[model samples]
Target chain A: MLQTKKWRQYATFYAFVSPWLIIFIFLGLFPLLYGLYLSFTNFTGFNMNQLKFVGFSNYKTVFLDSESMYALGRTLLVTAINVPISLAIGLFLAVLLNLKIKGLSWWRTAFYIPSVVPVVSTVLMWKFIFSGDGLLNTLFDKLQLQPINWLGYEYATTALIVMLLWGAGGSLLINLAGLKGIPADLYEAAEIDGASPVRKFFTVTLPLMTHILFFNLIMGIIGSLQIYIQPILLSGKTLLDSPIKPNYLYLVHAFQQIFAFQRFGYGLALMWVLFIAILLLTVLVFYSSRFWVYYETDQEV
Target chain B: MMVNAGINKPLLRVVVYGLLTVLTIIFVYPLFITMANSLNPLYSLSTLLPTAFEWENYKMAVTTIEFPEYLKNSLIICAISVPLTTLSSALAGFAFARLRAPGKKLLFVIITSTMMLPGIVTQIPTYILFHKMNFIDTFYPWLLWGIGGAPFFIFMYRQFFSTVPKELEEAARIDGCSTFRMYATIFMPLATPATWTTVIMLFQGTWGDFITPFMFLRDEHYPLATALATIGYHLPDNPNVILAQPSSAAAILFMIPTIAAFFFGQRYLVDGIAAGAVKG
Candidate 1:
């Protein structure tokens, strides 16, 4: 009877999670493996029956293609600029608010609200502001400043950076949580020692908050690398049309290769290689994290 | 929260408040411009505030597209996807936390590892899969994805469930409560915070999802979010001459639901981010 009951319980566990199993196996895992297969075949999306295996050529093309190389370089540059600069602003705001500021919730709400606005809406708002005779130019005109086309090639990346900083509130919340997590006694001791606020920040706050900053850094890099819709919307272009060359990030380039050009095999290969790039960078970050990312652990003793 | 560590309080207070006010304007100004310009097209877009209250811009925006149908489609997408994804995620999460089955540990690790995988890798194959299944241009993909259970939410629910005191679960098990019943009656009631966090996130995610529908659907089937791309294309000949009037009105309308979600779930949302970050 006990054996039967155990079997029934096990069956029930499987039964309860059956939906996830079905979907994950077929949709998640299968598609991932199938993508790898498709990358090796010269599949132009429409030619399923006439699929010819072309080994390693698609991968070679992804690496050798000049536009693809440029896109990768651009994406890395943007990610590099975005992560530290945005996080610094976020940390600064968090520190400002952590000083027992009046109306803490109100301050938080004001800051955190923008980050939650749908990316589509945010993009549209910025696009309109960047339009030829948009509000921004009008403001510039009022001040008698030169009203250049804010949406032009030179300023396109600048526009992206502005949008990045606008949502810096996201990192603020995380940093604030980290700030609050620091023990009060440390600050108390710092105060008793007559340490200045700046000294206390470096000695007490920064050391404890390294892990949170590290985590934010990882997430920000990963998220920024996937940026596609923003540039597309900002340029007022569709997925089919290429954004201005400066705005062409790797994902957008890969997307155009697949959908616009119907280079399915090439696109799949492009993504797989990009995946490897991401994995390698992530591994490097993990490897280097030991030098910078501090963690409280058993090894501390 | 630390209040004092030999900082000059009054000087810091003045400086902080001054900077906070400036930051507030910088953050909220563009949104304000959009809302203000949305009011009336005839007025200049120069002002910091709304010049006129013209509700006609919105009505015109609606008439420009198949607005009602797309609105219904968005709602239906949200209705189907959010609850289904939330529940399935919770179920899987509760099981992962509370139940014992062979290979469960391995499966959990695999699912969580996908978080680090660049999402673009599977984009093509998943599109091909959906196309083959004739799931293209339909709500079928959301149904399947909802059941697939987003790994992030699963982790969130699992974390929430794991924190529940063991005695409560054991007492219920001793009372002969089935695993499913224990999840629904005991754990779920306790998991309301996680549920709301997951639900709001799911809702916002579904409501604002453009890429999925952009990939899969025809123009007739686009949701409110994707459909907005069609509006204010009044001058196709001069693409640069974007009339920011009715589009801004529409943009504000599109923004309302998500801004509402933010207001409603701010606490849970913050907690969720903090939880996810701490795990990382």
Candidate 2:
């Protein structure tokens, strides 16, 4: 009976997780391996019959192709610029909101309203607002200054960043959660030790908030690096017409390659390169975390 | 909730509240203008307020696209997918948190590491896989993804379940409760916050996802995100200028579900939801 019970317990675990296993095996694991396999072959999506193993050539193209290199560099530039600005602004807002203010929830709701609005809808609205006769240019005209091309090639990237930062409430909410997660008793203890507010923040709050900041860093990096849709939407065009060269993000480039140009194998190769790069960077972040990220739990990583 | 413990209280209040109030206006003004424009006729450079409360633009917004069909499809897809994503993720997360199983540690590693994998590496092959299986243009692929257990939501549920005191789990087991019973009866009820968070996330993700529909589904079956795109929502400012009103109006309509989800979910997301889970 005990032996039967052990078998039953094992079966129970499988029973609960069998759905995930079945779906993931066929959909997630198989496709990932298949993509890797395709990356090694000369599969042009429809050339299932005339396939040949052409290893490393596609990967070689990723490094040598000037456009690909530019796209990668631009992605890095975007990640670098957007991540820090977003973190600074988000953390600042979260800090402000963390105080014992009246109607805290109401303020949070009002603040987050813009972010929760549908992106497709909002993108168009922003497009209009940035249009030549739209509000911004109009204000310029009213001030007796020459109207600026807000959506022109020169300013489109800045326009895209503005749109993104406007909706950075997700950052605010997470930081608030992090702030709350810091035990209040820690603050009281610091007060007892005669630490000034500034000193307490630097010593007590900053150390405890590092884990959350680390979470934000990793998420921000991953998110900003893979940003594809914003440029596509903001460029006022379909996937066929690329976002202006300035906003031609790497994923967007890979997308155009696979779908528009039908370089399936090459696209797979490009993606794998990105995958490895992300893996390396993420590992670097994790390694760096040993020095900065603080933790109370001994939970296994 | 206090910060700046040394500052005079009234002075601090005046400054903080004053700054936040100004900041709120700065943030919300653009949206307010857009809302005003949606209800009124064309917004010239100078006009900041609406003279009329005409919802004709909203009427046009619904009529302009395959709104009814697309809305139905979105509703059907989210209604089915959100619960599937939430429940299955919760179950897997609970197992990771509580159960002793073979290769559990390895599975946890797999779960975390897969998150670092760029989504495109899998999308190409998955698209082909779906095409070969003849699941393209159908909701089966979405249903399948939901069953696959979103790795992110699983991590969330795992974190929540892990933080619940071990004594509670032990007490449930001592009462002759099966592990599954402990999950369904004890933990699931206590996990409303995590569940709500996952629900909103899954709903918004599925709602905003145009790529899946754009790539796979025929135009007739396109959802809101895809529909809005092909309907020439792009601004050219002259011939298509009249289209702006309906578009802004549609944006407000489009925002409702996700915003509603946030309002409902935010209550559960309040401070230390799990702190109260452990009973005396």
Candidate 3:
């Protein structure tokens, strides 16, 4: 009788969740599996009918291709550079805002406003800021310094980094929440024990906030790796204008090869490789996080 | 923790106020410059402040970009997608929190695990899938993705739902309310804050999103972001295009809705994100 009741309850539960399951299976998992199969075949353009069973050749081409290799390198480099810098800045800002300062809410809101702005607007804003005769250049001219090429190959990455910092508001907002969650009693106890703010921060705040930090780090890395619109818009591509030919950025190269050149097999192969690389990195991070990511539950540890 | 300090703490006050002033300037100055430069008659690259406020740039921006059409499209997409996403996620969230089911834990794990997969991996395949389904140029694919509950949204709703008192739901059930009715009448009303948070998030996300519309929609169907991009980059020579004014104006206009939403929903956002993080 108990088993029958449990079964009925389970049926109701499953019925409620069936919509999401059906969508995930059909739209998410099916496409993923089919795409995996297609990656091993020679499928190009919009023609699924023309697929040939090529078996590992497409993967080989991706591995051997210089352009793909360059893209892979650039993507990793950007992630490596941007993630740590953003995290540090975000943490610093959060800590500053967390202090019992006047107009705290207003300050927090101000810092977060930039992140909520539309991407196209932000990109356009940055483009104007970085233009040869735009704001930055004008400032340089007033200072009697030579104007730098902000969008040229040597400086484009730097420009991207600057633009990215404006969006650090999201990370900062989350970190502020993490800061607020740390108990006041713990800090008071530490102070009574003659611990300096710096010592208490390292020993208590940093260790306890690791979980939130880890979440932010993983999300930031993943988001940065897939960056497209900013660079695409910055390069000034339009419907009427010829598609901005990608320069050295690996993402642009991969995007062009897939969309512009109609090499779906190669694109799929490239995407899969990226997927595996990210998956491995994430696994490695989680594995190492056992030492540092302090879960509230001892069972998790 | 209150400090018993003298009233004449002049040095400390000066330092604190100075630091705050500098940071505030850094944050607010860009908006001021953008708004100011947009009204300048010449639209020249030289001036930091407009010699005279033209007021014509706003008019040009509205007329030239067909701002009304773009705004209409954005409203329609947000209106359709936000409610659908909120409803679906809320239902699934309630199930996870309240229902006892076989494979519940397994399903939760599966859904959460999907969060680990980077969006880039799915982009090409999903694009191909949508293309094949004849959804490339239409708004259907964009709407579908938005309405489809992502792991983050599900996790949030579940966390929020778990906090509600079970007695309320039980009483409703005892009053001959079906599970659906109980959910609709009792649970949903109690979860108004969570619903509002979800709506604000979905609205901002759909409003600001540039990539999906850029990739999927053609020129005639281009939304505000795409239109802004075109004005900023493509129509540099066409002075008549409203978006062709100094980039600052375009940026300011684009920021207005998002900034407004953030301020309006500020309290809920901080609470929701913080609580959600702990539960997650």
Winning candidate number (lDDT): 1
- Give the least accurate 10-residue stretch of model 3 chain B, judged by summed lDDT: B1-10
Model 3 Cα displacement at A227 (Å)?
A: 1.1
Clashing residue pairs, backbone N/CA/C < 3 A, model 1 = none
- The collision pairs in model 3 are A71-A250, B60-B242, B61-B242
Instruction: Name model 1 segments beyond 4 Å from true.
Output: A1-13, A299-301, B1-8, B42-45, B230-232, B236-241
Give Cα distance to truth, residue B80, candidate 2, Å.
2.2
Evaluated at residue B219, the lDDT of candidate 2 is 73
As for candidate 2, its clashing pairs are none
Q: Is candidate 1 or candidate 2 better by lDDT?
A: 1
Ranking of models by TM-score: 1, 2, 3
Per-model TM values vs. the true structure: 0.94, 0.92, 0.91
> Which interface RMSD values do the candidates have, in the order shown?
2.4, 3.2, 3.0
* Candidate numbers, best lDDT first, in rank order: 1, 2, 3
lDDT of 2 by residue, B1-280 (tens): 3556644578777998998898787667778777777887644342355666768878877886678888888887787788888889999988877776687788778888887777667888988888988988888877888888888777778888887899998899789998888999999989887787778878887887777778767777778877776555433455444477777788778878888888888876553222222110
lDDT of 2 by residue, A1-301 (tens): 9888777777777777777778878877899999999998888989988999997989999999999999999899888988888887777777888887778888888777777777776787787677777767766777899988878889988888887777766566777877877888888888888888788888887887787778778888988888887787676545466787888989888988998899999989989988888888999999999988887763555
Writing each residue's lDDT as its tens digit, candidate 1 over A108-215 gives 877877777888788888887877777788888889998878779898988887887789888877898788788898888888888877888898888888898887
Better of 1 and 3 by DockQ: 1
What local distance difference test score does each model get? 0.81, 0.78, 0.73
Residues B87-191, candidate 3, lDDT per residue (tens digit)? 878888888999998689999988887877655556667777888799887888756765566666778888988988888878887798878888888888877
